[model samples]
Target: MNALKNEADNKKTIAIIQTTRIGDLLQTSHAVKLLKENHPEYRVVLVARKKFATPIMFLLEKVFDKVVTIEHKTAMFGADNVREALSKLKKQLKEINEQNIDVSINLAFSKSATYLHSLIESSNKVGPYFNDLHERVITDRWSQYLYSTVMRGDLNPFNLVDLFSSIIGTTKKLTHLSNKDYSSEKKTNLLIHPFASNEKKMWKANRWVEVIYQTLKKNENVKVYICGSNQDQKSADEILNSELIRPFKDRVNLWIGLDLKELYSKVDSSFLFVGHDSMIGNLLSFKNIKTLTISLGTVRPHETTPYALDNYNLAPKTECAPCFPKDECTEFKCHNDVPYNITHQCIGQLLNNNKINIEELNSSCSSLSLSRVKLYHSDMLDNGDLYIRESLHKDQDAKEVMRNFYHIAWTSIFTEINTSMDIPSFNIQTKAQLSSQSKGIETLYELSEFGKKYSRYIIEEISKNTPSLEEIRKFSAKLDEIDRLSDLVSTSYPLLAPVIDFAKVAKNNLQGNNLVKLSEAAFYTYNEISLMCSVLYEFFEKCSLINKSKPEARENI
Candidate 1:
């Protein structure tokens, strides 16, 4: 299952193990491009699932010097006996092992991938891999950030590509698209993919039918390409055969059951792309083609939106949106939360190569209608990473303001970068919320000081000739209480929970061989949180200087 393109002539190889779905494979490409660009002499290899990598061979061939794929289903199920299967797997792995991989990075976040990471032969390993205790351990800061913030909840501020590039040790956070692909040479074709990985993540065919019917009617020069896989043939037919779409038969192209490379060609011929939260949106991202993603069900628009500039995302403001897969929901209300009218409006603007403006959207959409969904555009963050910036919201609310504070705290603590301060105008309610945050921050900061004090006590006692175990235990118990109290503070504020959780995880994964070294590591852990709290407290102090005005509530970031 090891598919080698042009061989690397005795160059050091860097293997990227990303054994996930098609979307993740596409996400990995962004980082691979940066790695190769930074170290062109180093041969970059990709370790992906056989099924996911094969379909995108046309794309992967251009990015990776060599692709090592895992065909576990064939090796396990195709074999006649257990011994034969074992032989088959070992044969595939032996080829991978012989590559003498200089660095093996695991972008795939799974137990199986973690186990596989341990098997790869490399002088250095990054991302998560199994330790001697068979427990998953991540040592790199970026991977640790991914484990703490991203793997836990939707509050993570960085895009997946940004995290991947950081994990690969790349210096710049560059966008993948060049101006050459986004030129006016493209035809007036629009690519629309309505299918998702599961029913929970997409809308019904009738909803897309209405959007397509309106789009074709408004733009007579544009043709629509309904894009999907072979499995979506039945669903694609339902949209194409709708009575509303019958009049636009000449303007519509049904692209299904074709090679993935063929789909890339279709993208070249298209001027814009509109789709649900699916792989096609990620695939279309390689090009700068304007995209409008209607994220429904469990999709966190901020996390999964295409990592290209000028991309737009629309998700329901529904409280239950971006729910977990395990949550039982027969209602599927998030789908209905986004009306098709706004979708068509955004497409109309993007198709004409018009930048979406707040006034432009306000001219056509109602306030109540707009309130149900939020429109965001992919823009560069202060650290050069990609993030969803609110395009239509008019002001920063309490939650948005808190997110900005956390952004500063995380940016200050994890990286050496300092973020530009963004002081949002506050309403009376938001001012009250800020007052609450001030209290919460003070409490949390005090608790972090206690953590540092306890760890310092342990370090001090350990330095003595006759260290009392009871005193060490007493301080340790006090430190444990401080952590529990910090967790309780998050329940009141809710916004500060992620950092506290991350601090806990870091303490649990503290490195060192003995108590002295371990206690120092623990002290560093608390010191970082203490620094984060200090940074946040400075922001609140800065906010105190912003002129507070009483006015009608407005939305913005």
Candidate 2:
């Protein structure tokens, strides 16, 4: 014992980053525990997310020395918003660097997390090497290796927990239900977490009502408890209203919005959890419980199912399964496939066996679907097609593509008009106003006018029209003009003069397009023109350049 203690005392400062969600923190805690058990004195710092920080603190006592929490909001829209998030992230990296960490492990699959790893001055950094804008050099195939090691040998990379565990070291130790120190609490037969991190991932409200109804009918004694955050309370209320559940409403208790530790305590007490494919489902896997995860096509049964425990994923195989981080289908065909009947039957099977069949847990059963929108070199792609490649040519082909894209964009604008046309049924505006507004004048329209009256015609026209070859040529010419402008700004501006010189030298060294060089010259000439215009404007503002508020040319009048 003394020898083991002595070896443990020699451990170093290690940082573990899992800045995702509540379930991610719980899943990675196993690795933290493993490290702590092996090296008790190694100072472990957990960089957790703000929402789950409070819940994570309870487990920090023995496994980690410090809990550094970062607040990050997911599912944000717009490039400007994303850029602001990156700025906040840069601030976080500066703060983390103060700790002088020895080794950093990033478990979260975020480009921002990868960027953070690159910014922090750590002795050794390990994480998956994906295409990151921040860390252009540091290479680590940790996620791949992790998947190769921790999962069952025959199956492909599917289970996320096993994939995450693979990054640390290999361990076949069966992950049991979290040992919740619930000596003061009572035990429960079942826990039902119906809510998910996002609205789209949720199974239909009526389907949940039916599942609870069928489960209670099968076993009267089974204690049914609803678990979720505060956001889930409304769904729980709807479930109680179902005719099948009205009699059992009192027995079907609601335990939503409990802090992380409290939620874990509840999870520890329950025998099984009936929920969707969510972070909670993933966390339950580590706790060794029979979980019936209802996956509604946002992800695959194989790639993101519950990790390290006996669980059954109940997502029906569809043409649009595993939509991934983002769904491309405008109709959301993925969610439509998972019906109420399928969910009820899966729960029935789980109730019959009372345990998951490990053999059936393989990846082959998953409906694997990849996202159509992929990020590449700060550019966007549609279903892996490089629609917006780096501007290489000053030719007609590029111009034609741009023009066609603009024409196609009008379809979206027209859809907005079609939606607002129904607003008149609400008695919000009169027919005369709608007709007058429908004339398609925007810049001169009254602020009080409804959008349907003023903009619908123009929107419709844009939707109807297709791009011509000439239009494509004009679009490319505009881009070329912008490039020329940038070159001009670089040449004439004192602050940017060095940049222009460097670009010129680099272009010459690499033998880049001569047309680009000519464009640069034209841009510089335009900058000179702009400067002359500015001087003339200032001159005109003076009394000397004007004849009593009139220009010199109009002085005769």
Candidate 3:
């Protein structure tokens, strides 16, 4: 406590580590700004990727006292590159260490970020880091929540900005200059960004044409500025050169390959910003511009939509709306389901002097059989102004959906463990009927015993100077038995069906001759099965103690 006091008295230096892409890095700026705004005495520093940092250095300079760039790509590649990067990294680390940073916060939940967090010396550290044992450790509750339940789970309602704010111990919502404050000149253009990191997130080129054509028809004077990276030029050309849109090319302006400052300038001057889920969308939201974001592919609109009252997100209604990696989509139904007419209507409403009646549009659009589209905007005040709606669907609160998902997941895990403990023991029966009745119980008992035996074998194999292929084959055979038993158990207990899938994935990974990967897979499978058995055993022990205490309870009765 005294040391912390002394550091504070001597003007502490706080470093924030965010080596992620531009969108995520921009989200962290709010937290960084709050840290400086609330504590003028503390020196705030930003450590970011060299490629991503240079483009946003001007904006970063406003919030942070200094910006430190790490050449992560070079540091992680070829031998010559590694040598040069290490030499530069040594000098950078030396300077950072000399600052005697009082607090260090790692905002990225990646392996590289974890390793970097381990290297930084600080009086206090928060977020994920790698331990000496090479294990990943998330030091804060919020970060752990993000990793375990929020990242892949459907029920997380808080936005990444909200999570970032919690990590830095601030409640300040992101504040940016209003569009009016930045640009007093007449806003005559609507900016459109039609590309994302992946094709799945992109609306079809024809859809872009429809939106632009509709917007121009509603207001002929408003010009459309199409914005994107240099890599996106081909796709941008496709949208602009489409036979349907070519006639209106005179009014469309291509703002390709613009730097961040230049892009910000265009966004500020535009009457409305329209795009899919991307960094620029978020950047526009950060600047408090009125934005219309279309959510397609794996984007969870509730989590990633830009933060602003006027910002609206349009998402398709699908069971697998936010599927990740997105490589599995043979037909991207989610993207196809979003009607371009809805986007056209949204743009028309924003550009029109009088707001279009939403109820009338909803009634009219309902007849078109377009997949149900919902508009979402930030609502909750405490959660860094979290996004919310009356309902994602009829009678379903979006927040409650996420909460219920978490509830069901935890309940399923607990039920499996508790049920495994209460399973009755089966004695061998000579009668066919009795044996048939006990089949499910017998299978579960066999699986439990096999799990223990397999775990012990793995331990023994790992202890050997060099375990032979024969031993590995034996372990694989045991895994096969577990899979068979799991299938039989799932017939009676449907909840245990995932166990079969888990075993199959482990087995598939073990097939290749990579000894290191095989060993890790074996250890991981063994540990998982062992944990299930251990929990069941603990429950069994507790049941025995309760039965033993029954005599005392009977006497009292």
Q: Candidate 2 at 18: error in angstroms?
A: 2.3
Q: For each candidate, what TM-score against the reference?
A: 0.91, 0.52, 0.69
Question: Could you arrange the candidates by TM-score from highest to lowest?
Answer: 1, 3, 2
Predictions: Cα RMSD each: 5.9, 22.6, 12.0
Model 2: colliding residue pairs: 146-166, 158-302, 176-287, 177-287, 177-288, 437-453, 437-454, 438-453, 488-523, 488-524
Q: Scored by CA lDDT, what does every candidate get?
A: 0.78, 0.47, 0.63
lDDT (tens digit, per residue) of candidate 1 on 115-229: 8899888877888888888877776667877788777766776778877887877655444544345554433778888998888988899999999999999989999988788
- Per-residue lDDT for 231-305 in model 3, tens only? 989989998888878888899999999988888865653467889855787777667777778888878776777
Query: Poorest 10 consecutive residues of model 1 by lDDT?
Result: 548-557
Candidate achieving the largest lDDT: 1
Alpha-carbon runs more than 4 Å astray in model 3 = 1-7, 76-85, 173-187, 353-357, 367-371, 382-384, 390-394, 397-400, 403-557
Instruction: Pull out the clashing pairs in model 1.
Output: 393-555, 394-555, 394-556, 395-555, 395-556
> Which candidate would rank higher by TM-score, 2 or 3?
3
Q: What's the TM for model 2?
A: 0.52
Q: lDDT value for candidate 2? A: 0.47
